[model samples]
Target: MNAPDIIDFGERLLVPHVIKGETQISAEVEHFSRATQETVMTPKLDLDALVWRRHEVGPAFDTPLAEIIDFLDAVSEALDYDKNSYLQEAMEQNARIGTLGARILENCYRDIATFFTREAATAEAVGSFGSLEALDGWHRQSIRGAETDIRAFPPRMVHILAGNAPVVPPITIVRAALSKGLHLLKMPSNDMFTATALLRTMADVGPDHPVTRSFSAAYWRGGDEAVEGHIFRSQYYDKLAVWGGDAAVRHAMKYAAPGFEIISFDPKVSIGLIGKEAHESEESLANVAERAAADVLAFNQDACACARFQFVEGDDEQIDAFCSALQSEMGKNTRYGDGPNGPVPPQEAVEELDMLDMLAPLYHVYGKPNGGGMVIRSSEPVGFNPSGKIINVVQVNELSEALPHVTVATQTVGVYPQSRMGGLRDALSSSGVQRIVRLGNHIGGAFGGLPHDGGWPLHRMMHWVSAEV
Candidate 1:
């Protein structure tokens, strides 16, 4: 039987294109509000063929950086949410991600331009290799009685994309293009449409463009040896960029061979730190609470960088006031108006927290316990993961007490009263947190040159080639 056609990026819907191999696998992809049945070709372990294709496409992408940036700008404009049918379909298909809403989706689509700006792209290239000249061509440097030439060469890359945010795939695409790497993206089940839509935009930009030919996006169940075993071999891909939960990270780690490397963006949690000054005046208290609410509800608290717990330096009454204000803020629309307003907490999570409220002296529950945004006041961090805008407000005499709870799993620490950040930064950095930002700005809207999870991803993704003479 002929394989069913899946959504290929506006190129063609031919069954032969959909299934590249003789053997085919059929599956149903759940698009939240709807489900679509599709078929994927079982991968043929042709390492030599894949590598040759990458090398063939490499020189074409070695165009001037300015031209590449211009191409990306055009792609970004094509992705604008105003009248893009592809983006609309992607938003609908990705709706099952739950935390995403129309406003958030629009922002994600619009932000693609930010990643590929001339300033950002230039900064990334320079930050990665020390100079754009190094990436454009080999640069010579003299050593003791010797000369060495070095260039930043693009590698054959396999990106195991995370489904947490729609922007992730586009960011990865920009990195791959800037580095001139041949990229094969493995789409997550929860977000199958984003990569396709972005790739389709690239196709629209130029069907025969080297950057277009160098890219391919497809889906297969992760850990399916029939697929991953063949592609994960070091002969085909030089690097595997894995972004997902612990299980996914661990699975990708197994495929890292001697010559090949794995760059893992593992699961992480975030928290907020409010100073005691928040309790000194009504205005201060209100400001801190609003900022805390922004951190907690950023991306509807679904982002790994979004703060889930707030450690406020205050007494009982002060803590109560902050919680009251937080509950109100969580329910109301914010600057990104009318987006997702926190999901309903799962019954198991609510039930577990309810039991804790009864037994634990530190636990004080506020808002609707079942869902619709709940805040728990506690003397220490709660054991369960707080979801659906359920924030744990831990009251402490001093902010230092909260440091013990900041473990290796912590990703970002949003702090209030900018003065306290200087003192707390070193401690938080040592505790395995990656980013520290002002309480209200933890969403990571910066354009580029920022290290994600404590490393420059574009730098790490490329292969640095040096020749000594």
Candidate 2:
């Protein structure tokens, strides 16, 4: 017998319970102290009580595949700038609230909602992405030939929101819903209201939109496995999407069942690359580094895609010059997490930064007197050694060594000479790494609808019925 068209979890699911078994928790709020490699909660969160917070928010189940496509059509239409206003007052609102909020903490949902209104509309910037390019090479692989069967399967996913990067989690929600998945979105305590507000707007776009029945949002602590274990074991969800530190992923993984899969976008690292020739413009390195610094400040060096590491090609002087440039660029945003030009508290972040200081082979030192926000590193190291707060500069005689360190989880690596992009394709083509930007413009940049890391998520939570079409 087929399951009901609509399903609801009647009781308020509090404590550590999982709605559909896939678990996405907020590990972004972790305190990276030297004593503990894992992030300690900065939000003063309540994990134990959230297990039972599940209530009847909306319907969740499979919609006909054709209906799914129609919904996508509606979304496409809404994204149309000519017809829809999109993000007019949104960004200005974002600047206002984000600046006033003083920090992008768990408690800033209202401001985040205002910001999303702006940023989401920034799609208006490039025709609201209607004309935007899809990031993955998967589009080429999505074969539309009649020989290939387009089986619309409803996958299950658990979306863990990242408090550090407010707007990012909603993108995952859109991806899963667009693919016709039954999405169980576990809200990060810090930003629950923000996603809730988004879903509310989505409801406006189309009340009976399939996302209504297919998506559920709530918040719980990252490591609470008692509820997650039961939820994952229920075999209700197929994919798990987590965004945060490695420990958070490990904790969520413990609940993974065999048939049920995991889509973990865990703690990833990103960097920048420059050909030696970039040193010619002198200003070129600094110009690019400043843009890259904006990328780091976008989410306060919290997003996996944040360019925490930099790989540059130059003489000692050139590298030093680049460092100076990055410092000057990064100088603008003194505070972190959507706040105004406030002060960034690095006591916890610096601990990890200091520990990595010994492990990292090279880095330029900044801070002290001038205070937080400085790039550290001379050249790209042979391997990865993360510094939480300080920027680790690795002066590489060659770019080849940095290749091993870049992974699917990496979001963007701004490189120079833009043409060399094709040359490194063979060397850097890995499953987890995403895109390669040219020199600067690393912040607020993208090829829309790209699956971060490797396009390897198909293995998770999919109800595949393979056939030779």
Candidate 3:
């Protein structure tokens, strides 16, 4: 059986567990292969730890980006799927799904549900944090220039899924779907489950949901030209949506098919800019620190948008106090895995934190990351390599200076004072960063479908057709 031209994920199902002794997503007619991380049942292959399974041949690539766009235009008109209410719908659905999955997954979905809730609100406020509606608008505008520049080619989209954060995939999935463009989703092996779940949910909502077809999420072992090569060919996807690290994206760019366009959200290095006011009152310090703690636990600070560093505008004493408050906040992260039966994080993360001890005053609180994570620490700056460790505090004279060293992966950087945001927004995007936020809730935000890469538009994902009647 051929895959649907568009899939809702509700009807199409998971494959049966060939392993025989474990729960799995089951279905028949295998034409695609998926990857999973190194599992007890599956041998490890390089860095890809996904469970690979072949599925039925997907519907023809003949649909093309132009046809995809026509479908979106039709859906946009038919469902009156108010391009603006995506966030509200997402929150409602997230809550519904979270409740539904709670008993089965032991409430593993609670955090995800909350993530959707928080991000939805953030997206609505900012125009890009949480909904498909918000993203479609922005993607449309981004493609406008490309539409004018070139006229009959489809977009080659490369989306790099970020494992640091969760549920981020759906935001991209929806945007690409509505843009009516073909999608090349690079699934982060670690967080593939959520996107898979959300896809299932979209199907539950309806098969004709734009998400049903027009997009294909897969794990091609990063640079496996066999998969990416054939798919990213010049005649293939027109835009690329990257959601991983700098190295991941740089490598992805190599496989970028010729004549195809590449639009990406490369690795984002985010920070927290705490104003001296945060330290003015003891209560404020504690309050802000708790907020920092919440941010830390949100996806355990894995997103490029998550705050890896902070520029506290104050003297060492003030900065130290904020650091202490932050440390206090870190101590409260309990979402880590449960008992021995639960998931465990990498020992390498612990080792990395240990290395930080050589530089700064450091400490570690025991907790599991996968399920049982921890708060690893040091007073000095972390080794700077990406691993586990949520908030890093650095005292700064002005928050703006920290922008240069920032990697292109910088997604969301949270600033404390709302008043100073106008100036900082200019500074944040002044470099290659995407969102400059005053509220520190950076981990779970994607609304209003704003230009995700610092006002970068979505029209870049499309090709134009100009004809006179």
For candidate 3, write residues 247-350 as lDDT tens digits: 87787677655565556666656767767778779998998876665555444455555566666678756766676667656655334212222223457765
Q: Provide the clashing-pair count of each candidate structure.
A: 0, 51, 91
Better model by lDDT, 2 or 3? 2
TM-score of each: 0.87, 0.66, 0.63
Q: Residue pairs in steric clash, candidate 1?
A: none
lDDT tens digits by residue: candidate 2, 332-375: 65334332242354576555456545663454465531333666
How displaced is residue 136 in candidate 3, in Å? 13
Per-residue CA lDDT of model 1 for 50-143, tens digit only, reads 3434335464447765666677777776766666666766675465333467667666766665666667777776766676666676778897
Q: Number of the top candidate by TM-score?
A: 1
| Alpha carbon lDDT at 229, candidate 1 | 78
Using lDDT, give the best candidate's number: 1
lDDT, candidate 2, at 251? 72
Q: Cα deviation of 366 in candidate 1 (Å)?
A: 1.0
- Candidate 2 regions with alpha-carbon error over 4 angstroms: 1-150, 333-345, 348-364, 369-372, 379-389, 407-411, 430-432, 456-461, 466-469
- Provide the overall lDDT of each model, using Cα atoms, as 2-decimal numbers: 0.71, 0.51, 0.48
Off by over 4 Å in 3: 1-160, 184-186, 208-211, 218-220, 333-383, 398-409, 444-446, 467-469
